[model samples]
Target: MKLDESLFTVPGVRRGLRFYVTGPTPCPYLPDQFERKAFTHLSQAAPDALHHQLSEAGFRRSQSVAYRPACPNCNACRSVRVDAQSFSPSRNQLRVLSRNSDLIRRPVEPRATREQYRLLKHYLVNRHEGGGMSDMGFREYAGMVNETPVQTALFEYRQGPEEDSPLVAVSLTDILRDGFSMVYTFFDTRQPKRSLGTYMILDHIRNAESYGLPHVYLGYWIKQSPKMAYKKRFQPLEVLDGPVWRRLEEDE
Candidate 1:
């Protein structure tokens, strides 16, 4: 596909930064549709600041690259963030927290470990079978965790406070100026009742509140995708509409 030079003119984007559009590919979230993306590399010139600016403008970081959907005929993907300061857990969410209260969360450097890869492998096989990341090997997994120009961390969740407890869940997160961006999260699929996925997000909300951050970027949310439906459960969700963010009402 031809590079879209017009995207370089976006405000806050530094001069000389090039942007390119990807050729159309099958859309993962929708049926009988294709998707494309506008992406640029986060070079050393000003990686952190550039990442923050692009993130606020609805781009997501994947390793050292920032990208946003540029589908020609569809705008189904909407960037969503949670208002952490004003967020209140509902009864169900509270229960999810209580259920996994014993799990200990530790913020570690963005380094890949054998345990994490093992958990990721299990998660892919059981939860995301045949998906894009299902067949990822250790080298690629390491790149996902370690190849970042912006500030990033891995929040590892273990069953207990003991130093040797087995890891139960992990979230690869980006530390943004305004909030934390949940780049990706995977958990032990054996314990469905524990609701580790929801718990990880809930923990991030509390973590953001403790850090005095106002928002928690949850990446793209497509209303028609069942896989993305869980994102809406967080109340007072804000979605990027054009250049502005609008709150999603409960009735909508």
Candidate 2:
């Protein structure tokens, strides 16, 4: 059966079609202000052309949902991507890379696991207990891991005896034709010294380079948000400005 493309509507002022905006909710990145999002759905039948158009137009996808910036009076969130080949880790990043040298990485078909959910719950409780995903039930976690219409995988990082290594971290990523986008990542928060978060970004850079991909989308980078500020640390990055990605200087 053919999918109805008409059900897919582009919301914009020029089209005179109002994009539905959600009610004001506490901003997740910022401290107190409310945030609203304008979003559109992406059907399984949605072609690659439409997906590319939406992504280039500044929309982000998580699971099966695609959302764009529609802040009524704010535009703080900026979409950022890194030129994978040009990204060079700093001294601290190199230290992190060296620390995780023992762990092995493998990309597998995305799937939900009981152990993964447990780790995810611990990560949220210890690291982001008050955040939006803290209360996500196992089923919701499964949806997050398994719901996808594109090439996706979970990069698992494990340590020790090969057969008995624990799943220390997992990154959900979408493999685009030209680049890769990190949809989400979770790790054992107890291993603070390992700096698994930084390790994952570095690993993605290496992964992109090895696969001959040019860029790695790091999602939105909010300079004011501590949680997001780490993104800027990956020097020689490009920020999506208007319709183009502008590279930043060393001093920037």
Candidate 3:
């Protein structure tokens, strides 16, 4: 796969590798603001070190591209990661874990399955109706799960250890040199009591700590978005302050 030669014809081919910017789209996390993304393609030719660098620089991988918020007017969308070494689950989080003790987590290759897609559709219908991914078809979902240029994995949660236990949640995760980047996660929305979303994050934080990893990237944490506020719950959180990873103070 050659670099997109036409990209060099564009005015801002400034990076050693080509970078492209997406047109403005309505901000899904904020009101009355448009969002743009500056992204570069990820290729098998040399992506491992580049992927690690880009992630540390606040870029997120989606399929074959690594991108970050390029919105001209807003900087509220900060990339955040949980400090796995210093993290301590709050009482509520402990309760959530206790409630989900029956659910067994399984790690598998990043291959999309019909069962996962169906559960995702059900979750979207109940939890994120009309959101961007509400209409994702199986083909699109498969591409999302399988078209990675770097190492990736899927974590599935089920009811019990039995091979046929009901599948309840799935997380698409990117394996980084130092931590895990949670690309996306969806669960059975019907079981509100389960708090599956938080459970998955807790599980990741624990797993990363156990494996000697120090961070668990949680993507953009928009200050004004209630939906994104949850990312901050796993303290002590670190926000990408330009090139530095600093402690995001509590009550901030």
Candidate 4:
């Protein structure tokens, strides 16, 4: 398939890109299922424009690769993003904001640090014991944070505004031309009551609004995946349905 250049205000449309599909792997978020991905490397002269177009096309970036689910028989993995301009927090969500009000958000460079790596290990051990990234080491962690080809930002959430405040959470995000894609986030599990995960998502929406961006890409959400159901809490969401994006209905 070829990308339509008529739909953009940007030039340097990439051409002749190659895409491949991986062999089926056990579905991580669902049971008795398998998954595949149609992916292409983020190799081009204009990486930012290419990244933006692919993201609008429902592809997500990992390192230098852009991919989306291509499970031939199953399309449960739907790409979803929040309409940052129209998002309004629920009562519970507001409480989450209040709880983390003391946490200061600091945007840092993409380079990784030992402090962040140690925090990642603690988060993984408590929250995702046997998941795919449970065994990730510092080297791999650094690569994940630093090997990006496009613009990226790492938000360090601390207990205070001071540079030396206790770090409690970290969000590695992709800054697309039109919005921010939350690539990954990890936090202090010891303060679960702070609802750090929910707080981060809310903060991203707030961040998008402040930047005058339209959306906060939240990656894929599956109706049957309990792990992803929380994404629905963010209203005014748009989901990529095939080649079109439309407002997600309440019943959907």
Query: Per-residue CA lDDT of candidate 4, range 144-214, in tens?
Result: 99999999999999999888889999999999988999999999999989999999999999999999999
TM-score of each: 0.96, 0.88, 0.93, 0.94
Order of the predicted models by TM-score, top scorer first: 1, 4, 3, 2
Error of 3 at 208 (Å): 0.1
Clashes of 4: 0
**Ranking according to lDDT, highest score first:** 1, 4, 3, 2
Model 2 accuracy (lDDT, Cα): 0.78
Q: Clashing residue pairs in candidate 1, if any?
A: none
Q: How close to the true structure is residue 50 of candidate 2, measured as C-alpha lDDT?
A: 49
Top lDDT: which candidate number?
A: 1
lDDT score of model 3? 0.87
Against the true structure, what is every candidate's RMSD?
1.6, 5.5, 4.9, 3.7
Give per-residue CA lDDT, model 2, range 1-252, as digits (tens).
Answer: 222222235422123233455677888888777777676555546434445556655677867767765666667788888889887788999999999999888787899988889999999999898889999999999998898776788988999637458999999988777778888999998889999999999999988999899878888887778878788888778887776679855554
How does each model score on lDDT? 0.91, 0.78, 0.87, 0.89
Best by TM-score: 1
Candidate 3 wrong stretches, greater than 4 Å? 1-15
- The per-residue C-alpha lDDT of model 4 at residue 250 equals 99
Kindly list the per-residue Cα lDDT of model 3 for residues 84-154, writing each as its tens digit: 98999999999999999999899999999999999999988988899998999999999999999898999
Q: How far is candidate 1 from the true structure (C-alpha RMSD, Å)?
A: 1.6
